[model samples]
Target chain A: MSRRPEPVQVVKERRDAALDTLVGGLPYLAFLGIRFERRGDELTAVLPFRDENIGNPLLPALHGGVTAAFLETAAVVELAWSQLWPQMEGGAGAAAPGVRPPLPRTIDFTVDFLRSGLPRDAYARAVVVRQGRRYASVRVEGWQDNRARLFAQASGHFMMPDLSAGPGAAFADDEAMDPAPPASEPR
Target chain B: MSDDQYLRIAQQFIEALPHARVLGLRLLSVSPGHAEIELPWAAHLVGDPATGVLHGGAVSTLMDTCGGAAVMAHPAANAGAATLDLRIDYMRAATPGQAVRARAECLRVTRSVAFVRATASDDDVERPVALMQGAFTLHAPRLAGEAT
Candidate 1:
């Protein structure tokens, strides 16, 4: 008889692979050089410092929108991970065909700028405040050197896509459905 | 500040932002209490590969920068301001292969804060891709050539 892998190990591998797929699908995240590190089930979103991220050369601060975007991305990814966890756990071996859940859509996002984002690597973590079948609320906090002194904080509401319908089903009629030729160069 | 001064300041402000340059954000127009910026479509700005739509983050950045420009252009505001809080609502994803433009107006300026309202749209003018409202800290007015 062939040896079988432990259930915990299988779940861990699936979690990592799912996360790669989730984050890899976003071109803007790749453009901004934002990456994720998973420690157990927790995720820390990192925005590596780049000259292009600066808004004010004098103050040498990161762009406010970039900060907000980082927070929002963190929230969205966290919410998606929370939704993915249970499904991955339940269907360990019986993989559901054509059941990739679509990304959650942002309804509204509110960001509070506490301090200027310095020209350094920034980090963010998001917590899902509440997630229902159709809607989710997430709160994210971003910091540079010190987590206690957050540079920015954000709360956002997202419209959860119907997981039963599978990927692309929810956005088929919209402009997002049409796929264009791949760009030759990365912008 | 005079209209010309405001225009010059707005131009200089947008030019000084490195991220704005990276995103190729253009200052289309600026006047007292009003400013307009445009972001051309680029392959790098696409948020979703499946749909070829520009990222909501890119739109957020454009609107935020536009709001700050409007605040700076306001007669009551000074040379520099910082965003205190900003709220953005995604109306819809922007059309692919088209440029997005954001218009912002400084609705009210208090002693220490400036209020701004902004909207972003693509080719379709009737429906906006996103709407933004923000509060910005107002610095004391300074001379054109004054050092920071």
Candidate 2:
């Protein structure tokens, strides 16, 4: 006979489920090869280095755009995952099931590069500064070797959909994006 | 350096980068203090599969590449430039299946730094998908007597 599942184990299961929902659904995150982990309430995003990610082969440094993309994805994933954490809505205890938050739409983002990103597994952590009915603001820090010596810091504002509308409302594309520019134009 | 040489360097810079090639970025034009680039939409580039929208990260990559190109195009810095800071404001989600274009202008450049501003739009130039401002550290050109 199996013993009762511990509270810690239960929380981990819920978090993993939440991650599957978030990461599995987002193709770009998969394309970037981003992974998520939890230590207590903190969430970290991991981007493992690949040959294709190098921008300056001479410096052998990670591309600036790759790091920025990782940071932004980290912030968004953290925000969405928070809704599934039991402690977020309720105080401590096992997480309640089926409270996944709606995915956010980025309104603005800023990344400040403090150092050149070396080729390695990069990690990022994010904190939600404010979460309101219609918007949320978050701050993210990215580092490789030492957390104190950060490679970059980023902050962003995201538009949160109306909760009363429906779960699918947040993903709706009300505005049309760019029309495909002519690819034949000479560079 | 002549404008033609600057253009050549800018083009080579984009082509040399593997990540830019992966994103399918094309260097459209580069003049003194200004550069324009284009990114074609791909299915793997979608941020939200539910909506088939291009990820904000993809747009950020386009902006960063354009801004760096603008800084390099500036006549003052013959060497190269690195990103110091970049801020992007997402005005709207890029509609799926549409190519996005980014135009960047190096607003100012000093002894050690360059400032740039850029806008990314789909088909309509007026309706932008994202706006960006960035600062880049410039590497000064080598002097006549300076050793390599």
Candidate 3:
């Protein structure tokens, strides 16, 4: 009889082939339910609006806390799309799939709100003014409908990590471990 | 809670919103998305121990509110919307023992969205210490007569 090969222990796994840069995040951001979608230069996403988020009554709108969250999400996602296109289009990025580096650390960001958000679903769209070698500039716009009035707008500057250093990421312990088995897994 | 009370709503916002702290953020004035707000340099807001500069989070909070109010003051949709997201980048630490104020203006407002830009500084508006921009949505009515 042929000798059986030793069992191979699956030590690592991934969702989209190679999304290394995506999973590494601070505990606070994960706690806040931030999501990133790489959809090319024209990026869009929805922040789940909840009534309980109102914090400051003096300004009285959707608390500024929530507003900042949206801006941060858009910035990272926009860059991802720009960086990921080649991979998706069957170039170099596609071969690696999920091994992209973590987003560059932010250096400085500026946000301006033209109007207050009422208690309603909000949508956001981002347009990049310039995506350069060391830094990238983006303009994100949030709205409910397309009534020409915006809920918020954002512009940000981020410092790209050296490719050799690979975004200098540190993963949380809990996040580093394997996710629990799904309920549908065979017993 | 008097309906006619002329006091600024900063206290009430803190009283009800447990997770959201004031962080020494104060309103200087509100004029059609063109407004001024302040951040007091206190013990709790300091991030560094040696020089005692204000924390980045504190400046971020001030920017968030100042920008939001600037948008709310827009003439198009007075009811207000919700904040889908906000992002801030700290240029550097601020000088200790000095209060900082921000000047904000609404750049544009759509039926569904509002845009704003702001600058923060201690004694100089020309050389801003920090820059901020945000977007807001409009509000619709809930059960009973209410404006959220």
Clash counts per candidate, in order, are 0, 4, 66
lDDT of each prediction vs. the true structure?
A: 0.84, 0.80, 0.56
lDDT score, candidate 1:
0.84
lDDT of candidate 1 over A95-144, digit per residue (tens): 35333356787889999998888889999999999998878999999988
Instruction: Write the residue-wise lDDT of candidate 2 on A57-118 in tens digits.
Output: 77777778888999999998887766545443364432334444557778899999887778
Model 3 lDDT tens row, A80-170: 5566545454424433444545444445665565566655666777776787766777777877655377767777776554344332232
- What TM-score would each prediction reach against the true structure? 0.87, 0.85, 0.50
Ranking of all predicted structures according to lDDT, beginning with the best and ending with the worst: 1, 2, 3
| Worst-scoring 10-residue span by lDDT in model 3 chain B | B3-12
Superposed model 1: Cα runs more than 4 Å off:
A1-11, A93-100, A171-187, B1-9, B140-148
TM-score (chain A only) for the predictions, listed in order: 0.82, 0.78, 0.64
Indicate the docking level reached by candidate 1: acceptable
The DockQ value obtained for model 3 is 0.14
Can you tell me which runs of candidate 3 are displaced by over 4 Å?
A: A1-26, A37-42, A56-60, A87-100, A165-187, B1-13, B18-59, B62-89, B92-148
Scored against the native two-chain complex, candidate 1 gets a DockQ of 0.46
TM-score of chain B of 1: 0.88
* Native contacts recovered, each model: 0.72, 0.72, 0.22
For model 2, the local distance difference test gives: 0.80
